[model samples]
Target: MTDPDRERPAEADDEQPVDAEAFYEALDARGRPVVTAAEVAAALDRPAGVVDDALSGLESDGDVGRLDVRAAKTAWYAPGRADADERITVFEKRRDVIVDQPAQYTRALLTQFAHLENTNREGGYVYTVREEDVWNAPYATFPELVSTVRSALGGRYEAIEEWIEGQWERAHKFRLATHEDGYVVLEAKSADLLGNVAEPRLDDGVLRARMGDETAWVAEDRTAELKRTLYEAGYPVQDDRELETGDDLPFDLDLDLRPYQADWIARFADSGSGVLVGPPGSGKTVAALGVMADVEGETLVLVPSRELAGQWHEEILERTTLSPEQVGEYHGGAKEIRPVTIATYRIAGMDRHRSLFDSRKWGLIVFDEVHHIPSPVHRRSASLQTKHRLGLTATPVRETEDQEEIYTLVGPPIGTDWEALFEAGYVAEPEVEIRCLPWASPAHREEYAASDGHGRRQAAATNPAKIREISAILHENRGSKAIVFVEYIDQGDAIAEALSVPFISGETPHARRSRLFDRFRRGAVDTIVVSRVGDEGIDLPDAEVAIAASGLGGSRRQGAQRAGRTMRPVGKARMYVLATRGTEEEDFARNRTKHLAARGVRVRETEPVAVVDPEDASATPDGGGVGFEAER
Candidate 1:
């Protein structure tokens, strides 16, 4: 069949302009290609001048392009010629593609695909790698392949055979060199696959496809066609277009989730068990609660701090299907306890009566910030044995080695990075602007440089000038409702006093801290400075900003929690790290980020604080930890 003409004339048997359908019909009437205005007018029973005007309109709308124009003659049409296949488009035109898909077997597929690509280059066929193709596998594991194909290929398993046949006929003969249970190894010649008779040649690390055994290269426009063909054939997964918005949320919370949040939840719920790792405030609590709504029986949620336990209680009551009767809290100052409980990791980790050693049955146990599970006591308690487990944390484990151990104990990583959620508007996009306080300032930098080890971090963090700078920033953004994070109670007290904001430290009374968080969430107060106790699973949905004035230690869990405080997706949020120019405070801040590489958290220079409109009362865009640290 010849290509369908895709053009419309200015006028076709009408006093008014022809509609889009009529224009398409006119093109269909012209079997070969677009005709001259005179020819179109004759065919449409209209005057040549009217046809010319209509073609001009079509050209303006990108429906057609004019090839030539003259006084009494004119020709215009769509730019590209029709190919045999209309369902072809480009993939990852000019971007680098990472091989991360089907999360279950990403590494397995990467290994196989890379090996095949390297070994299969001997034949005449050429291979054109699209950015998105970086994530495909041989689909050797038929069952898993069937599931992925059904979801990705519009539930059309029948098309798989046809696509394979077409690819085989078009390309050099291909074979799965190694086909096993869940893995398949493939090798194919590019010439055979692409249906090009050109001999493939490598020039400067790029493989070029020749046309008709000639030296001429295929036009760049043809790349998309080739890519779309392979894409429909199920060679790879598409880039995530929807945000992780927690779409499969079991029970609808009175909240609107961003796309990334939905996606994250879906991935986890589908996987049944794994880690949901991202920077803090990425809505780990909300995500955990969402999962609890779907799971059968009671869920026990373990947090790291009392502040977090209380925060979880409030959020559970506010956002989950669980009733106060069903949900329980096992913490100090708790009046009632129920089946679906929220308990502190420290308390749960403690060997109160060595009861943890006994096998206790639970429908589901959620470890909020499960990275803390690696602690000797927590690990021992957690090792008490439970099959169904969910590790919810902004950062999971500290580094690769820890991740390996965590994987053996917990499960593989399930959720995508925080940036995925951030860019999709699931979480706010942070606007980062660096204000490099002068390192030459002798008062702070000099003292910090002279101190040794931990003292240096303390010196840098407590420097009068640096403190004043943070205090000023806090004062300026005071209306946005912020949290000042400090490493020690003394620092929290000092910073709180300096900024004149209410303080909650480890020593803060349970009832008082609960009241303080309540006041912060209600907008009755603006800022609350706290020690590390506030870093873990606490829910401060109203707080959109966090200031890390100190606590720049290498505790990946702490770093993740501090950043997470501002990532809650409650509205928009921003996290500010106040470092003393060039001090251990900065170095410690760097150490705090070591755990995020695997989880894909990119820690960089501080992002700009967003202006909070009192009328809106939403959090500002909290710059997610992605990309890399900026040079400050």
Candidate 2:
């Protein structure tokens, strides 16, 4: 509100006091205190430039603050107050917390039992406590969690605190432990619940014998099913087994961990298990090595594919003092059971391979891409009884909405705020733009409308016009390391053919895949087109750009994983998601980008840059119009 003619803030400026009160009110009415500056400007019915000036004044006066605004056009802002004011603002009805001007320690304390939603530019953070957060809170006793909640809130929130206590107690009702005779045992905190809730809920095949009213002998083979069933029944089984600490294999990490990595290791050590939910390039692999060093015992690392297994094997050798003889790879190609072994989930879950892994008293078991822990084959790997368990993932999201199973099977989510990591220069936050394209031509639109179900979906996903847009993007970002992701191999092949790049798919032989990926990493090729295999298996940290030409069936985790491919320690990274306008791809694109948007990533819908019709004989396409250009 300061006059442009004034050298400084004007006197009698009480009226020009940034009008922060109105902005806050507008933001509150929008049901989220955090918003882009553009959003608040629209809500206030004021000129965006005027709103920007007022908000900037408010920020100067410490009344308003920005969240971690990224390189894109998105500028996040929220209300702030004096440091002496209550840092934690609880919304009882919504069960969310808005912490203003919170210190690093306060944020760390809150993460023990609250899910950090977003971080404000004022160094404040937003967090929400869910049932899973309470259940997985790294506390041996309820009092510890309560103390943390109260300390972070700066006082008791009676209604929410009581609700949290109830959730914590529910998690304690059932526990899975090792019986003295070397079998898995299920115990209930009370007799009635065991007899009434657990016993009847589990079949005879699951519970072999009733040791007592509150205890039962569980079939080792059915342990995974038992844990999953009780969890679905609202009584999650706690794994408190006296499992093996494996043979001693001591080593030290050659890498110095970042502060956040150290904090993660500290928390994981206290719990003896946890999932490291960090963005890609946040040193999760190195942190895992630190964990292995802390455990000082043989470890088993489970990955979804052989590429990741090999990556893990190489990382373990390079980061730790472990030698090649000390480490081994167990998969279809090779089967070795050394002290430190990396195995695919399928190999680890097999009956024969399961025995081999079971026989080794692994002090630690790390599940890379732990999001896969909930699948049928991967869930079998969760049955292992070990002293320490760790899961790692950039996106702990699943379309099935069963991501909580990952927490139950492995451990709680332990992560630094992604925004914090970005701010600290540990990981670069990628700019994401959703490019919606029109149909390739009248013929293409007609074919899409004429078809049904899968045919229609295929038409939208493989729109020929998208290839033109991709060409324009690559042309603009030339000399950048890029990966074009596709869901279908046929589409990938076509794009590869058009782009003159190698296409890597599941059908690509291991040696060929390895050679292409190596070439990409070595900068021999600036770009490559890949299929779904690149979603999780590809770990190229130097990728500067990711163009999701065709996303899979609207998987939120897949979208996040693709964006994570470019999260690096330096330089700007960008993600372009292409979808056919006026088709199911619109909804699919939204669903795909939802996770990254929720995590404070800037996800904007833009019209693709001018795409020409290949069938046209002229310079422009038929019925040509200027294309939508994403904000640079």
Candidate 3:
């Protein structure tokens, strides 16, 4: 049998004579000794078969060597020019491929390169360093190899250090520790150094240098934020912050709950910490009590005011198995600390008494009107240790950026279905009327124009025309329960005196305020004027009407709270806001009503009605009224 690869054919006489030596010399002149059969044929102006025959003849004569460059392709090279088995070099080899000076590599620079490679995982390049030959890893190209080596030797050793530090970070454990000065420090275990492990902003001198072997420090109050960041970055964290636990005082409570209230309680039980947002009079207190019952341990309740604290105390006694002996009040002159304690934010946040509560263990801590918890003074309560935390509020928003702090401290907020509750008749359907009263008294208008921003606003908010409107509203709703919300104590007093009704303010004695609230609840007093103290966290379930004579400047929280004061379903409850037309009061009223307007409550406007001037007539203030024409 003949070998097909070795077969050769006879060349015709018309074909030009093949010059193997000249062909090899021409291929060498082109800077490559290897010549394919097709190139030989083209250079000789002959067919490929003819060139193949000549190459076979030359190979038989042992003057030229054949090499298989690839499948079905042959190359003729001088015997010593190249080797067939050698691997191709994609880049040039240089003596400086390995960096000599280690200090030239920086962690940040290496991290930059590593991040580039890491971000493109499918690029077939390895940027991570290994323990062996980690610094001298192979490069994909000659230029890149030269550039990387030169950078490593050019006083940038931190690059290599950063890569190694990342490796250490992935395997180490981190923890938090509080310093005596109230600052927090981060410490690491099994870490040789803390090179670029955390953000540079946290690298104060105290922890940066000493982090050489198994310890690092940050001198900021944002330890919680830092912990989250580090944990997300693939660092193992062992949280060391102290958490206090109260005595397990279990109890059973017998009470009926609405479906949504029970659902919120179940959610609280699962998470152990969260904010419950519901409309006013939606039984947030009942849900909180249900959480307390489920927790079955010592509970501490925080409120925004003394009145709210008293309300919480009363609710705990009325609704829970815990008696008055188990509950205690921590506001004002009383500093009792029982299994179930109710304290105002002012009392709980007091530096002198903060330690008393901070040191004790609490199973549950309930924050009423939790929106106030974002304030700097009130935020201190966030650090208190409790197994379960519940924040209850009718209005969970604030007009400030501190609103985010509430979520960070407590947990994510879960809100009740306001529309669902309203449809189910669990809450009132508000009929809001915006009475655009004309600014009364030329003296008042002149004073308002002459005053600065604050004084001007006060003048418009307290215009005598608003008093006339309030009087009309009171008379329109006569013989029914009503609460008038005033911005100032003097304004509440004036309204109460003119209408011959009771009034309450911050300075009103606790006993007298309680009695007044009771009288208003019953039919003894048809109306009562209260200051901003009644805007939030006070239960006035039976009042069918709320009159807003004055309010804070453009505060949605104040507006929502005031509207919520009459949110108890009582046969189409009404909220009457009296604002002077074309003044700052109108602007403020618009700002306040925006939140309510979003919830499908239209503020119907009413033209001012003419009435007998109280100063000139002997007519009763409640009866000398104006009729309203609802205008959307």
Candidate 4:
């Protein structure tokens, strides 16, 4: 049986006959060194279609090379004369090729040979021959290449020089625009080959131009200073978006706001967004709540931790007229959205939650511990549309430069004077003491020297001498409520065991932690040992003393937060920091206390204390007890 789909034998018409040498000679004899297929057909006395087919065959066989000029013009030259390694070519149009030739080859060739410059006067086009298009051309020195380019572009187009200068200027310019959604957009223009600039920088070196398909888009909230910076840099800016405004809605709360708290709410009402920096237990939360009540619409509160979220939920229900049914918790498994939603920063930044909040306009957004919002992960939540924003934090200064970003994102800072509060007897005045202690035992010193950076810090923080000093400080303040801060969980546990007090860490269950906190609040517990989890937004107004036994190295923010834990209105509070003298720990201690010192808190140095050598189990010259001099 014969199959119609079976392959058939080749016929005479299937393969067109083309004389390879004749085509080559014909191309070589052309008046113009490079000619199109039509010109080659005319010179060869052959049909244009036949000539085009022949040229394709020649290209595939490596006998000729093809150059795509402007529009539909395809120029052909001898393969050896137009090979990639021998010349540099620049394209006037953007195109994609399957296999890209190496750019270094062109650069090297340009360095050795004079570049070939082609100009299409009629088409208003000018470009140099690309390295990939160079097959076989004479190579010259780099100076010769420069001279060739200069000679080619000398007088034909004086506008080319102006265009080059214009490109340089464009690459450095940035413009500010407002997106339809009200976020600031920074667009960067550059003379990139494809006219696409990615991640460009402005003149100030701080603002970055984000890249888009055609232009760079900056999606940060812009301040007046940023606008002025762009204008000074000679870039046009467009900012037509209206500032957010909130209605002075009617509401009532039985709680009396402090004078400072009332001033913060009033300022926030005028601006519609701002950061309120106040000491812990200084009624910052109360001020934020007052704003929420006055805004009188859907409210979204973002907190740093789940515990804080729970705290906010409790406070809202107790202090406001809003009913429990109107409030919701958008955290973990409970993904409820209501008129008043309290969510942790982590959960609220999730796509599902962000979309839900962004789908509608919120009346007010309260960012607790707003300093955390400058981080990239938390900053995404700032994109939510809201009429009013209130940022509440004990520490407005961040460890990183992103502090500036926070100022722009939330608003300018309106801070309460901690020193003024202390002087006026509105907040507790702290007596700071820096107690220098001797190094640990000989064995411990050797271990510290032999360990890595992290291990050495741990050894310094957990020194036996420091621990003894902490014990002494605790004994001295036996009747006062105290909080001992430790960097590590094991340290907190050890200190808690030694002091016979309750300990709290991130691992503590909610109910147990709450009970422990309640016990401390009721004066049932004289001292509580806590890890870094208690550093921020935890109200411990009754704590009259703080002993910082361990901490992160040289973190001013951490130091400030720990000091703020005891800054309630009361008699003078005592803060004791135990550091090993003549070690890196001493340097870190100085750095840690710098923030406090800047705020006019006097640091008094106490005489050094010496301890017995634990390795030899030997007693000191004055017996087995540690000795300390009175404050100097």
Candidate 5:
């Protein structure tokens, strides 16, 4: 039976989880060329013995070439491997694929069919393709998926491809479509499968009644749970329920979308849902607003913080024809729900606030920083039941469970090429470096050694030596706008005091914080020391240099956000990640920034010899150590 969804539509990349060629291409995506049976098993979510049998069959069929393990991992990893050589490594067993020196178009292609684990600085990347990735593949039909895989890999894996086919088939077994009677009904291909799979998995009250042998009435406000339950049960319910565009809030997009952004809007126009994952400065917010205008219904924009909410307020007012009265802020300071409301995730998820948002028939619900959607508290907002839901984020990095929940809650990951954006001069490529600073004193080293767990992390993160390094960077890049990031308020205060800059944190008065931020934006202030309050979604576009004096417990998202601060269109930007030398900080520094290193920024390491004395830190020669060039 040909399903309507499986039919080829004009949209090529629709974020469904199945594409024919993904399984075989997973084996070929970059890393070490020779994959063991265990790796294949992990990638396919099958057993090692089963993978070995499959590989053995492939070997017999002369479809797969086996190389000796003695070939050396580096030998298999061709430096800057291009499209023709296809320098991609697949550990199907681990369900991970690393693209080495990926072609610009390849990364864009991979996101359509795989979940990005991390990107490399050397134009390489790591991806994890699984049942969800294949099931949410952008293509409409199994044959189209196969065609994409063959086109991507220039070959195929019949065995794992079979696994992909089954998963894709599983995703289409059921759907929640609107009946002509204006009620949602769960329709399945077969009554037996629906009774056996759907009836058993859904909650007691969810399936209100049976309409026919293969369709059932879906309880009101139970659609989200029903879809989630069925999805976990290995059957992704296609939501074809009719969606209202809500009360018309007339507005026109004042900004022109890049080609990719336009394509994103087009694909989303068809499905009415998706997450726009673009790098910072790649204009995800712009694309999201574009979608808002396209939807043309009353919209609800949920942001991670009030700062972002306010930013969205300004952006909406500035970029669209929407009047200030048409838009309102709903967060800690405000609770006015207007035709187009922007609220914080914290408030939007609250019981009292839920009604104000849910009561409105929103034409669209845009989840900004969509990465926050998977959290326990934030996930509640996902139940708002907007037909056209859109999400926006620079870093979509999260736990597998959280990532999957985000995909399920909001929509599948949709992004443009980070490298392509950099290449096109749309976003500046940052010069990133991990600077290993010496301890301010032997006492600091002793304290770090004596501390344990979080204490140890804090000690290293707040090492006084980072101040000297930051000073040196500032001195060299004097007059350039800079922002120093710290993990603790105390450290932020100290850095701000030494630098003679304002320290903005959660405790900062809203008016004062706004004043400081405004001055910095206008170049009235050259720098500011801010805590986690400045870690995300702040519009500091003129920031030329960013220094991370402390790590956020080594979170890759935080690292990327810090580096992303200096990334803008048509400028040279630089980022410095400071870690105390001869400590665990070295490892933490590397671990956090590796995500940015590969995607578009090539990270260099520098270990300085000089140490700064805390008592006379300012007297230190040129801020503690002769600067070394990018490490070999």
Candidate 6:
């Protein structure tokens, strides 16, 4: 049976003709020649109307690509590369063919992509495109390719079937050669294509598609109904099964589950969908897996970073009985499909060129670092029709303009309070001590005030004199293994240079960073001056002290995460924040206090500052814990 979607319309008598050879020759002649209608007519030795009509027809057929020319009636045509790419052609053929035979292809793509997204929020799946493939070539030639195809078919071919069977044979061959690299290309037309191929079944007013051996569920076509129901229902808890730990297992995974993690699973099981906002070391990852285990669908995890993807891969390996084959990692650099997949945000979101929509139907999508969903690409993931969506983040709130989009698109926050988590012992609580640094010399103060917010914070945080005081305090009081965190990379470099300690940043390579983290973990490195790398994901449990030199104003999540580095319940933890007195630094420090308070972390100001011992001590300002010796 010829599906209506696969049917080509009858050729129009007034439709344009294809000048395939002429178009190809014209594209090949110039080193970036701007072809105007007059130029095309001259080249083809045809009338201007013929040239214009032919070019328009080619553009419509996706053979020739058209770009607008400013203040001109003529549109420029480039080759449409997708038309020539065998991978796309084959996909087009197979997509339609499979609908008639094995309808599961559509379902498989949707399911898998959806599941992978659920895994982590910030990471992207890489579909490895071999350098040898023609499809991976530059985007400039795509319009030209399309134009060539259209011109070759000419105006005589009016029906889609006739074009596909006759003149499009070459195009079909290109599609056959180009493979998906395990990453599915989700186009705007894909949803409609799927709807047409698989007869949609109406179940309890919900939309269901049955394709070959598989049946998949889609969000009901309620238009405004779902939102209305949600508003009226007020987040009713659905009956879902919670998985018991160590009760049923397909594989032997090594890891201890905290009771709070069990409760996280239970909550997800109870409510079905919500965001898991926790501070660092709160074990959000493990809890997410448990939720996946409890849910009926295969788990799809998405993360923000490649390192996090690797981390999840290692953890998933430990937990699932699925072999390496079953667990696929779809990132930007590599593209292979798997039943249970782990991917990055770049793969699922903005990296649309790779066409991620080709994956299977996702039962659940886990967004690690939920705050990222506010990003333009990530926000779109929330609107995707998935069975369950879980967003995981250490700090979920960022004052981005797209917060409303996040709420509507990615499910609303489940209301997991950071303080509540600490009180419940899901996360550890730390004692926060505020240290006031003395005003810098007049010259230094002028320089600081002259700089931007970031610079001012740095000048205050890394004053050479303050480092020595911190050194003394660390030697006398904090852990042997301590992390001195600064807001700026330069400040980190300065402190590390001064203290003769190692440090890492976003620019740090994976191996070197891993080695540094290991050394810190093993206590081989006593003090590490890390910038923002310490904020999320990396586990530094043994460290008992966190010295925050500078940070955001009223960023409760940042404060909680920084403090949580030492609050791992291994022992009593102390978080010392050095704030320069009588500046925005003081105000920024105070503003963040409220959010941290939610985590049950209170910052107590120590009284009566002690000056560095020396002849200068008598004259020096008594800056409490804040006054540290210079970077010496």
Which of the numbered candidates is closest to the native, going by highest TM-score? 5
TM-score of model number 2: 0.77
* lDDT for each residue of candidate 4 in 1-632, tens digit (9 for 90 to 100): 89743655434223545566766666566533345576677776666787888888888988776764211135566754433322222332321111122222122222221222221212111224332212111111233323333322221233433343343343235545557776565555444511332223233433445446444444354334454444334332333334354333345665888776787787676656678876676778888888887777678899877667777788877887777888888887477787888888888788866778777567888999898887878988876777667788766566684464554566556655465456446678677777777665666666677888889898878776665677677667778889988888877777777667788998898779878877887888888988888887566777889888888484677877888777888676888877766568776776676555544455566754434454555533212344443321
Evaluate residue 60 in candidate 3 and report its C-alpha lDDT on the 0 to 100 scale. Answer: 77
What order do you get sorting by lDDT, best first? 2, 5, 3, 4, 6, 1
State how far residue 591 of model 4 sits from its true place (Å).
1.0
Candidates in order: C-alpha RMSD to true structure: 19.1, 8.7, 27.4, 31.2, 13.0, 26.6
Q: Over the stretch 22-73, how does candidate 1's per-residue lDDT look in tens digits?
A: 5555555764344456556656777667777777887888877664311112
What C-alpha lDDT values do all the predictions have?
A: 0.50, 0.78, 0.64, 0.61, 0.74, 0.52
Expressed as tens digits, the lDDT of each residue in 242-263 for candidate 5 is 8655678768988888887887
Question: What is the model-wide C-alpha lDDT for candidate 1?
Answer: 0.50
lDDT of 4 at 597: 52
Report the alpha-carbon TM-score of model 1 versus the true structure. Answer: 0.54
TM-score of 5: 0.78
Q: Which stretches of candidate 4 lie over 4 Å from their true place?
A: 1-250, 608-616, 619-632
Off by over 4 Å in 5: 1-128, 136-155, 597-600, 608-632
Candidate 1: which stretches are off by over 4 Å?
Answer: 1-270, 279-282, 334-337, 353-359, 399-401, 432-450, 475-478, 568-572, 590-632
Positional deviation of residue 424's Cα in model 2 after best superposition, in angstroms: 1.3
> Which order, best to worst by TM-score?
5, 2, 3, 4, 6, 1
Candidate 6 error regions (>4 Å): 1-256, 352-354, 401-407, 412-426, 449-458, 607-632
How well is each residue in 356-380 modelled by candidate 6, as lDDT tens digits? 5334566777888777776766655
Consecutive 10-residue window with the lowest summed lDDT within model 6: 112-121
Looking at candidate 2, the ten consecutive residues that score lowest on lDDT are: 67-76
Model 5 Cα shift for residue 409 (angstroms) = 1.5
Better of 3 and 5 by TM-score: 5
Tens-digit lDDT track of model 2 for 305-423: 88888888888878878889999999999999999888999988999878888888789999999999888878888878678999999888788888989987787777765656665
Q: Looking at model 2, how many pairs of residues clash?
A: 3
